[model samples]
Target: MSAALKIGFENPVAQSQAVFRAVMMALARPGTVRRLDVPVDAVPALDPAAAAVALALCDYETPVWLDPALAADLQVQEFLRFHTGAPVTEARALASFAFVPLGGEVPALDDFAQGSLDYPDRSTTLVVAVEALAEGEGWRLTGPGVAGEGRFIARPLPADMLDRLQRNHALFPRGVDLVLTCGDRFAAIPRSTQVDA
Candidate 1:
């Protein structure tokens, strides 16, 4: 087995708890960047923050869909499976979570699972690995978690991301959420967020 497959939280319980808290805070305060402190050696073709998110959030109950680039990486697959126990799937709509790499082609927003009105929480949550993440001049975000409006900057998102997010927001109580990661930092953009480019 490769080193990456053996690399997981040194202290599974505490590390996972920290990562989970960071994830919750990020999602609770959209556009706010939170750092994940888990120690992960470089996993080939996998961003550390993305790996940490998967370790914290995915489990047997959550079926994950990987982008082609990530899906082809055996090390990444092994690491996630060993640590998260998440089932991998090729069907996007059936996925409860999806991992997409920066600069890769992303599927249409509608392609992911958008939960029914009765159970909006069943929708997929996307963990996107980006080149960089910072607060500055990029998309403007406003909605539930924002005090007023917040600025978020991440490079190489989908060309039609803003339009898609607008439409996604229109879905109201039934749309996917997003977690953007770069290195050890991540931020969230929930379905309740409105994005202006």
Candidate 2:
């Protein structure tokens, strides 16, 4: 928890570990959205796991973008600034990392990164903190990491997100990566995962 702030009654170290576990499970399961535990020990707009992510990932070298709706909260922003020394930027142009709060309109999937043909790894990532996460009637996912093809839905995702992600896969190693977080749970779906609607 290097230089991370103590949000509230919750332990920052414990929260960070929980997030790590959630992301690991999500990458393994693909389309399945898992639930994270949110202890009522923090302030509004700052979920325990979300705060943990700021602690774990953000640093001077990593630029982060949170939804503007949350920008008004100097407490949250200052906490991030003091703890991570992360640069904040606009949604569409955010480079490496993003933290999207709930209630605002979700951005177009392409707003982040889809990588590139030669350097697919250069794409940006969005750390969307959703209201809740659960399995839904989403497009079936079947690819390198999946055991078999299956239908998986997560929201609130963009209307054209699936299509854009498909196109992103055409670039392969160059497409953007994602981290979907809710409560204390999160999952990372790298560009390598193939999505078919």
Candidate 3:
């Protein structure tokens, strides 16, 4: 079969539910790495975890924005649209969810919607495919989900990632949340988390 027609979750409902739970748990425990073992046929330009995020969270109502490389891949577009029914958007600010590659050029956090004060939850969820995901090292994280503090790391992210994260955190109740994925593992850094750069 063509890459564009690649299968999504082997068991749609069950797999999506499992992936969703993993993603939520990661977010709720900020800096915690969760494994997404959902079986999915590879889609061009997207890591398995990234595709899992889309399948579990995206729907017809959510508009998605992909970085240049991902956006340019027609097969990736078809696979996502077919399985998730998410619209591909060109305007970053209009995106409900945006995907970027850590090893490639990534847009500034501000580029995506920072929802209004009255509707901060409307902000975009940034899903970044990174080179690595690990715990107990790198940036020190603290805030809500964290008990005392947590350490998280992702490789090949921009050199100014910490600065960008600090700025996003400063936005408080109105900034985009982030999910970093590598291979079949993923982790989150919600805007509420403070990064000790």
Candidates in order have lDDT scores of 0.86, 0.67, 0.90
lDDT score, candidate 2: 0.67
- Give lDDT tens digits, candidate 1, residues 1-197: 67535566788788878988999989999999988877865465767778777877889999999999889988878888888889999999899989997766778988999999999888999888888888866889999989889999887787788899999999989999989988889999999999998
Candidate 3, clashing residue pairs?
Answer: none
Ranking of predictions according to TM-score = 3, 1, 2
Off by over 4 Å in 1: 1-4
**Total colliding residue pairs, candidate 2:** 8
lDDT of 3 at 186: 92
Q: Which candidate, 1 or 2, has the higher TM-score?
A: 1
Q: What is the lDDT of candidate 3?
A: 0.90
Models 1 onward score TM values of: 0.94, 0.77, 0.96
Better of 1 and 3 by TM-score: 3
Candidate 3, run of 10 with poorest lDDT: 1-10
lDDT of 3 at 76: 82
